[model samples]
Target: MPRYFTDEHEWIDVEGDTATVGITDYAQGQLGDIVFVELPRVGSEVARGKDAAVVESVKAASDVYAPITGEVTEANGALEDDPALVNSSPEDQGWFFKLTIANKSELDGLMDAAAYKSFCDSL
Candidate 1:
């Protein structure tokens, strides 16, 4: 899997034409304790840079943007029961959704792990 990051702090792990999406660990850390997540409905169309989900934490509610345009295939059901997973395992089990990518070219504009780290460092 090739992982990419958005300036907005979202991460996507691409595998074939399907990709899994989530907020970066840095995002979870900044949000404090997560309380709820409003995931995009499966089969819904998502546009790159558009809001795909919402995460609510003790500090505030934040939109989770789509890193690439696609049709959502799955949304993490675990978040409904344990939103804190976004805090505990943000890069792994805390994943938000999976989608069938609509445009692979959009990935070229995203940052790789090292670049993302540098971007976060500069912030």
Candidate 2:
């Protein structure tokens, strides 16, 4: 299992120093139908807890935060053509980016799945 989560409701699956990042099921459910996703450029530097991208739904736009400090490696370009993948598979096909983490220690500040669930419950 992956240690994942952010206060912004982002989820991350870290593998070594690289990670795949995305929003949570609860987030997508609230966002409704995803129509557009503005992804960050590859190689962009992102600070933990800062806005890294934007996800726009039929309802509104929300900032997607960097769960950990990292250099963006790739983004879901497929979102440019079809954004519904976010609604159908927020954890899998809808993953937003892959990152090359700058500081592995940053992971310590993130919440694990159990903690994330608790945090969501509190929200």
Candidate 3:
């Protein structure tokens, strides 16, 4: 699966119309130790660049923005029980939600792995 990232440090992996969304490893590091995750409800509509979830860490709470417009299909329940999964496996098991993409074109504005890496390095 190809992964895309946003300036806000959210990463999204898309397969067909379904997408898995999460914060990048860099994001978790900045947030410190994660304590809680507030997820969006299934079937909720989300617009690109808008808040879809909130991650609370020892440092502060931060919004996880939707990288593409879509209706949420699922939220990661595992985080509710072990929010620290975000710190340990941010790009894998720590994913926040899945969405059924509403517009494929929205992806064009996002950065690919190479671009995102450079974006992070410049930060």
Write down the lDDT that model 3 would get. Answer: 0.92
| TM-score, cand. 3 | 0.96
The C-alpha TM-scores of every prediction are 0.98, 0.92, 0.96
Ranking by TM-score: 1, 3, 2
TM-score of 2: 0.92
lDDT value, residue 104 of candidate 2: 86
- Cα lDDT of all candidates, in order? 0.95, 0.88, 0.92
Off by over 4 Å in 1: none
> What's the residue-level lDDT of 51 in candidate 2?
90
| C-alpha lDDT (0 to 100) for residue 4 of candidate 2 | 78
CA deviation > 4 Å runs, candidate 2: none
**Which should have the higher TM-score, number 2 or number 3?**
3
CA RMSD of each candidate after superposition: 0.6, 1.3, 0.8
Best by TM-score: 1
Which lDDT tens digits does candidate 2 get at residues 46-70? 8887899898987789988788888
Please give, for residues 1-123, the per-residue lDDT of candidate 1 as tens digits.
Answer: 899999999999999999999999999999999999999999999999899999999878888889899999999999999999999999999999999999999999899999999999999
